[model samples]
Target: MADGLARVREQIAAASARVGRTPEDVRLIAACKTFDADTVREAIGCEQMVFGENYVQEAKVKWPDLKDEYPHTELHLIGPLQTNKAREAVALFDAIHSLDRHSLAKALSRQCENQERHPVMFVQVNTGEERQKSGVLPGEADDFIAACRNLYGLNVAGLMCIPPAGQPPEQHFDLLAKIAARNGLSELSMGMSSDYATAVAYGATNVRVGSAIFGNRFYPPAGQ
Candidate 1:
């Protein structure tokens, strides 16, 4: 884990230098989906403080104890979030990277009010316009972002996106950066293990890297 993370940090520094940005300008979110506490702890021992998890239930299982042990670490929800689980998500996540719809916004707004644990929110934009993806379509992003801030009162701090597979991601990254620029948002949570360097060139403030840092993941049986 130490060697892998060190390699990724080196890449991040190189990428940032190419664009005249320092390594401190980009935050690395160690995507820790499917990895267990031991693997994640190995990362923490390497001083990797920020992490991203996909499932709320899975995070619930792993993070509470981990957070107890390392109170300074921050956790982010980087996958689609269910409205029914908004309360728990608000309490557990330090940031949420999947605020795409109005109903989910309403649920999160209420939870933030009830719990007073307002997590930093990121509006996911479907830059590739993929039907199966869970993001606000690019055309509707401006209005949606406005409503999240004005109507729902959520702290919409940044934007996130996942370009369509097998396509050039630079255009999508550029689009996300433009949207963020016009909206006055500074954070852009795009890129992954594959294209983080390119994303840094496009002004990504955060990159979610998993496989490149943690290596290939092993999942349990389909129906455990």
Candidate 2:
């Protein structure tokens, strides 16, 4: 685990240096989805404090005790979020990377009011316009971001994106960075384990990496 982290950090530094940016310019989000609590503890032991999870329920099960033990660790939701889970999500995640719709924005807004806990939000843009993805289409991002702020009062801190699979990711990363720049957002979360180096070149403020640090994920046998 330590070796994996070291290699990823080295890649980050090399990429950042290529563009005259320091590694500190980018935040590494260790994607911990599908991994158990014990495995996550090993990551914490390696001083990898920031993490990202996909589901609210899974995080609810594993993170409470972990967070209590490692109070400095930050957790983020980096996958599709259901409106029904808004309350628990607002409470559990330190940040959310999937604020992609007005309905979800409204739900999260209400949950924030109810819980008095406002998690940092990133508007996910479907740069590739894929039909099966969760992000707002790229063209609608401006209005959606405005609505999230003006209508719902959610602090729109940044933007997130997942480039279409098998496409040149840099183009999508460029699009995300441009939208963020025009919107006065400085944080861009648009990288993953596979292409984080290229993402850094295009000014990604945060990168979500999992397999690179932890190796391939092992899913339970169906119906276990």
Candidate 3:
């Protein structure tokens, strides 16, 4: 874990340098999906304070006690979020990167109002329009982002995307950067264990990296 964390830090610096951006310009979220609390503690030992999780249930099982123990840590929900779990998600996450639809926006708004927990959000964009993915298609991204901000009253921090696998991610990253530019958003939550360097080169402000930092997730849902 220490070696993996070191490598990612080095890579992040190198990637940022390639684009003439400082490493401080990019925030690293240690995607800890399927990783145990002990591993997370190990990451904290390595000075990783931000983390991303795929499931609310799993975060619930892990973060409550962990957060109490490590009060400075921040958690981001980087996977599909169910509308029914909005309140639970509100209570658990410090940030959410899956605001892809109007229904979710509505549910989250109501929950934020009720709970007064305004977790910063990113409207996930499906740059490749993959049916199996959970993000707004590129064409609808603008309208969805507008509604999420103007109507639903959610805090639209930026955009997020999972570019097509085995394909060059530069175009998709560019699309996301353009969308963020149009929306006047400063954050771009893209990239992962693979291709994050390209993501950084394309101006990603927050990169969600899991396997590269935490080693491989041995259970279901595998990587983040």
Query: What is the TM-score (0 to 1) of candidate 1?
Result: 0.99
Poorly placed runs, candidate 2 (over 4 Å):
none
For candidate 3, the TM-score is 0.96
TM-score of 2: 0.98
- For residues 92-158, write the lDDT of model 2, one tens digit per residue: 9999999998889999999999888889999999999999999999899999999999999997899
Ranking by lDDT: 1, 2, 3
As for TM-score, the candidate ahead, 2 or 3, is: 2
Higher-ranked by lDDT: 1 or 2: 1
Instruction: State which candidate has the highest lDDT.
Output: 1
Looking at candidate 1, the ten consecutive residues that score lowest on lDDT are 215-224
> What are the runs in model 1 whose C-alpha is more than 4 Å off?
none
TM-score of each: 0.99, 0.98, 0.96
Error of 1 at 39 (Å): 1.1
